[model samples]
Target: MAQPRRRATPTKRDLLRADLRRSTPEELSHALQMLLDQSRLSRDERLHALASALVVEALAPYWVGDRTPNQAHDALCADDEELARVIEALAPMLLGHIEVREEARDAVATIEAMLGF
Candidate 1:
């Protein structure tokens, strides 16, 4: 009997790309706003949304291949000066919205360090 091949588990980047493909512009905008301002979402949720939006919406168009969020961040910092400037401009808003939650603090710090914030 022939067995079906099992699909590999989706990575976080895959999930984010899927979500971005599924979302409308309005929906993505609303989610971005929710992440930017105070919302019911936990800090972790907000951070996830931020990474998803930034990587999928902002960077993916310019990016050629699949990349994890961290990889994308590193690429932008190392190779893409224009995109790095864009992220720098956005840093203040993200920094302002940042909440000091124990669960998300390390993730936030990692992202901030990557962005040179």
Candidate 2:
């Protein structure tokens, strides 16, 4: 008799990291826009938190990657204006709904510091 092996489910962070890594720049912008729209329309605290976390995850690599936050931020702004615009548009909504969730706060703070807001 053979034993069956079970696969582990991915965590939310794992899923998010994968999504960010695999997304193209345009896809990333679209995802941010969708999250921003959800944040604007949804009153649910959990949904807001999730959206905020995703936005942060998308931007974190640029802001907190190998380069300095300022350097990454500068490069992003210079190289990808559309993506930068999407981030700028989403920042205030994320900041407004930031709650006790550490991921949400860190994400919002990363964008704010990156944008000099």
Candidate 3:
């Protein structure tokens, strides 16, 4: 009989969040510490939203392809204004296509409801 393949283990981030939901102090602290690493952002929600936006942006390369597409994101992070614009423009559309978590959905909404569009 053929057997099903085992799924990949959840990431540390996922484990951390799970621990948070369980009210485990160590896990909660780890999650907070992780967010603290990105303290430049005004809120964790904003960071969460940007993280969601980035996953959406990342998938663009598959559709954007190597057909003379912009290479800025590949070259350097935050050096691609056009990519940012395109990501912002296409975020809503991308949201429908992805199977993101509620947190990620909220993050996407955060980006959408920002000062601009």
lDDT of 1 by residue, 39-72 (tens): 5676766776676567455666446577766676
Ranked candidates (lDDT, high to low): 2, 1, 3
Give the higher-TM-score candidate: 2 or 3. Answer: 2
- The RMSD of every model to the true structure, in order and in angstroms, is 16.5, 15.1, 14.8
Assess the local accuracy of residue 48 in candidate 3 as a C-alpha lDDT between 0 and 100: 56
Off by over 4 Å in 3: 1-38, 52-54, 57-61, 67-90, 93-117
lDDT of 2 by residue, 45-110 (tens): 645666667656656767764787567657678877887777677776776655445777898999
**RMSD of candidate 2 to the true fold?**
15.1
Error of 3 at 92 (Å): 3.9
| Prediction 3 global C-alpha lDDT | 0.57
How does each model score on lDDT?
Answer: 0.64, 0.65, 0.57
RMSD from true fold, candidate 1: 16.5
After superposition, which runs of candidate 2 have C-alpha atoms over 4 Å from their true positions? 1-43, 65-70, 99-117
- Could you tell me the lDDT of residue 66 within candidate 3? 55
Q: Evaluated with TM-score, which candidate comes out highest?
A: 2
Models ranked on TM-score = 2, 1, 3
Give the best candidate by lDDT.
Answer: 2
TM-scores, one per candidate: 0.28, 0.38, 0.21
